[model samples]
Each structure stands twice: as C-alpha cells, then as structure tokens.
Target: MAAALAVTGCTSQSSGPSKVSSSSGGPAPGDSRTPPHSAPPRSPSTSAATSGKTPGGGSASGAGRTPSSRPPGQGAGFPHCSPGTLSASLRQLEAAAGNRYAALVLTNTSDRPCRTQGWPGLQLTSEGGGRIPTETARDRAHEAQPITLKPDDRAWSRLHWTVVSSSGDAADGSCPTPGALRIIPPDERHSLGTGWDLGTVCGKGRIQATALSTGEGPAH
Candidate 1:
C-alpha cells in the first residue's frame, strides 16, 4: 500500500497549476529562466537554483497494464500523496450549475534540481453514468512561468478544469463535473486547446480521479 509522507524538518511540498506564477525574489544575475513565481532562497549566483524546463509534454497512453506490474512512480510503492510534493495543486474548487471545476496551483518545492511537467488532465465521472477523461487544454497554453525551488522556495499557477461539454471554451467559462484528478507527467502534453476523454469513474468521499501517464501506452 502507498503511504502518506509525514516526516518533519523537510520542506513541506505542494502541487498546483503551474501555468503561471511570479518567482520569489533573489534571482541569479545570469539566469532568466527563473520566473518571478519560482520558489525562494533565491541566491545571486546559484546555477542549481534555476528551475529547469523540459521539451513539450510527454505522451500518455493509459488503458492496458497488469495490476501487479505498474509503471515507474506508480503502484503499491506509490506515496499516495496529496497535492504536496506533486508539481501542482487545486487552488480553487468551484461549482457552476451542476458542474464542478478545480482551479489548480502548480509549484516546485525541492531545492536540488527539478523541472515543471504536464498539463492538468482529468478523469471525470459523468452524472448518471460512467467516467471519462476531461477535456484537456494543455497544448493551447505555454509554460513561460519558471519555478526553481531553492532549499526554501516556492512558485504557483492557476488553471481551470476541463468539463464534459463540447460547446464551451475552457477560457470562455467551462467547468468540469465532480470527481476528477489533474494529470501530471514529465514527458507528455495535451493537444493545443483540446481535451482527452478518459471516461473516468466517480467514487465515494473526495472526488475520484487519477493522474495520466506521460507516454504512449495503455492504462495500468
């Protein structure tokens, strides 16, 4: 079973939408990659402090995997963690009509070296039916917000959730239904201004959803 992290003394980690965030003060003189919203402890000359960014997002093909043999960063050994440590977070949870959407806040909390990753994909459950991947708007957007977490650093971004609607634009005001989890990956990205439908299923208690993979394969 996956365990929750509760150790002390270490920097408390968190995840949210990482599309936008002003970097913390104290940027290196030569590194402009560090966005204004990057994590803190910003030094004047520390190459390691600058947040690294990857190429375009990775490909995610989730639908064919044996339970006993999951992919890396998954399965029984998974931390089963919350938004913390994760690169993004759901800053705001909103409800319009009968639909629900989450305003995500993505941030980096480590100091050594790490890069931003993935669009916030969703595996949502339909109202009187089954689940499906929420519409994804990962590609339509850009990751100009650089987040480099020093020993004690932070950065943030706010993003909206994709819903089960085909007539509304994500920026125009479309929300997702209840039960969804944002997808995070290092090597995959969604189509520009488009969304994928995973047919997610809703469960009891907190909203039900899972993160999408960052490669071209079947679900686990």
Candidate 2:
C-alpha cells in the first residue's frame, strides 16, 4: 500500500507516464547524497588515553598510572623508601658478636615529621642462595616503638643485623652484604627521600649505631 501511494505521488509530480526504476526498491531522490544520522564524528582533536608510563616520562594527561596496590596520596606497598620525600640511604654496616649490625640515618629533607612504624629491617641472603632457605633472614626486628621526627630531625634505632646464619657457618669471615627496607610507611603520610645508609653502632662493647633498647630477638 505504501509503494502504491509512493507511485501515485510520483505520477502527480510529472505529466504522462512516470519512469519506472529497475531497482527492486528505489530511495527517494537526494537520499543517496544525504549522510546517515549517527553520533557526531569523533573530534579530530580529541585526546587519546594511555595505559601506563613512567613517572617522569609523559605529561600529566598521558602519565600512565601505577599498578594497583596502594591508593594515590597514601602510602602502602613501597619497597624501601616512601613516595614524595627522598628515601634515606643504606650507608654503613659493621661487625658484631655473632652477627653483624647496620647503622642508618633517618633524615627528613622536608620540613615535616616523618612517621614510620616498626624496626628498620634488612634481608640476609646467602651467597649460594639455596632452596628451603637454609641460611637467610627477613623482616625488621621491630619492637613497641613508633618513630616520629620533627622537621630535619634525626633519630636512631638499632636492630640485630644478624649477618651470619644460626649455625655460624658464614660464607667468609665477612658478613654477606645486606639489602635494607624501611618499615611500612603509613597512609596519608610522607618520608624524606633523604639518603640513609648502613652504619654500625660500634662502641667499647657492641652494635652501638642504633640506640640500645630491648624489643625482640637476641641483642647483638
């Protein structure tokens, strides 16, 4: 019925016989010239998104996000140093009774109190690094101590830098070098990136680099 009405309309548009289309169905005149209605074409200038990139590598817009772990502006899964502030350096290490100890400088470059929890811990890995971990240590020798420092303030704490294994079968007379990590930095906080290093608390007696206080594990 719609086709018959369209044919009648065409007959009225002209005199005599109207031209017949060979096509099965013919679109109205000018229809082919018209663009189909659609969402506006994507803007040529529209910006594209990126998945991930290094911190200093790209603009803030293209700046790739980090892997999911800690939230932005909060601290959680940092390896050793916290974000924002400079991390302290692992400067010095020294000999101890059965095991060795390390001295670290908790320096706050920024003018703020750096809050940290637990003892600064070091990992003791053997030269061979065997399975079942025959000789190694992990985690800080933490105690009931919370660290707080005023702007540019430096405080000291000591840990059993147990360089040798329990059996006392050390690789060499010297203790294997250690890799250190800071206590988990708290959320909504920052630390002074400020280089901290391993230093021994040596005195007429013992590992005196960090202050002498009993918390956990045998004293060095």
TM-score against truth, every candidate: 0.31, 0.32
Q: Output the number of the TM-score-best candidate.
A: 2
Error of 2 at 79 (Å): 18
Q: What is each predicted model's overall lDDT from 0 to 1?
A: 0.30, 0.29
Clash numbers, per candidate: 44, 19
Candidate 2 local lDDT, 145-196, one digit each (tens) = 3333334544344433443343343343433332223221222122222222
Query: What TM-score does structure 2 among the candidates reach?
Result: 0.32
Candidate 1: stretches off by over 4 Å = 1-87, 93-102, 109-111, 117-120, 125-131, 139-146, 161-176, 188-220
Instruction: Report each candidate's C-alpha RMSD, comma-separated, in the order given.
Output: 17.5, 30.6
